[model samples]
Target: MLHSSHEPTDYQCPFCELLNDQPFSPDNLCAPSDLIYRTPLVAAIMACDGFGNYGGHVMIIPTAHLEALYDLDEQTGSAIMWETKRVALAMKLAWNPAGTSTRQHNEPAGNQHVWHYHQHVFPRYADDELYRQLRHRVSVEDRARKALELRSALFSAEHPYRLTDTDVVR
Candidate 1:
């Protein structure tokens, strides 16, 4: 659940706080993670409220804080989707779910809760309750572990998103 609002909020935007942090850390859930897989334009992090009933779930967000798809440029959008496809395949490799899906939200009216333009990628099995299950927040350690596994998969697995020869975290 992510949200976008041009209006004001009671407090502050968590994602903004994340983007502003100098040198993000993997252990800090509110900040960016070194464990996250990154392209030049986007970063994919384990969703803080990740799967309770599943594994290998993640959210891809632009490094920049754009409110919605409407605010994104073509290059950044392409990078996000490309990394998304890579992450989806990595999820398949790591978790082996029956299928996968991509989700995004806009305003509070549309079930958008976070408001920083993120895309949710999840693993789905038949008869699974990902949509119906509302209480799936994995422990922080589990999230970090799953993130490591997925990041390793992305680093090693040959994918279309690899445009140039590059090194990645192992």
Candidate 2:
């Protein structure tokens, strides 16, 4: 269970502090429900509304949180990029959109709320106005259900390896 947020901590960053304070839970360690892909070093999961505007809002985050891209070691950086490509491919396959955009925001000025460095994958479609409007109106329960549905679709036997990384550039 997540710890009480009322307790004050000396840690400077909220994300770092949460990581330090909470007892590690395997479920928490697992990707969020909207997760569509995973690799040994990185995982792609959907972001909550606080993170973005899209319904299929995905984020590729290193299994180990690194505060900033500059803070990432060379190996981790490469791994993140590899995982990102896999995610983009999965998004394209699932949404079949006209295009896709990948983005990363760091620090306060960059509008990063999680503190951990993560890349965003937004799927775009030619006629997606309905999706845009629905994304905004979705309730938390509806989002949770959709996330579960996405997870099942991505991980089913037919697509067992769809999200698995391939020949990541070392």
CA lDDT of each candidate?
0.69, 0.55
| Candidate 1 residue lDDT tens string, 56-119 | 4788888787877777899988978988888888877777789899998877666777657889
**Highest TM-score scorer:** 1
lDDT of 2 at 82: 70
Model 2 misses residue 45 by how many Å? 1.2
Q: Which stretches of candidate 2 lie over 4 Å from their true place?
A: 1-32, 35-37, 50-54, 127-161, 164-170
TM-score of 2: 0.62
My TM-score estimates for the predictions, one after another, are: 0.79, 0.62
CA RMSD (A), model 2: 8.1
Clashing pairs in 1: 2-113, 3-114, 3-115, 4-115
Q: Report RMSD (Å) for each prediction in the order shown.
A: 4.5, 8.1
lDDT of 2 by residue, 1-170 (tens): 22223222433443233223544343232223344445556656666542234455667777675766766788888988876665565555565667877778666676665557788776776555533434443345545565565555454455534432352211
**lDDT over C-alpha atoms for residue 125 of model 2:** 62
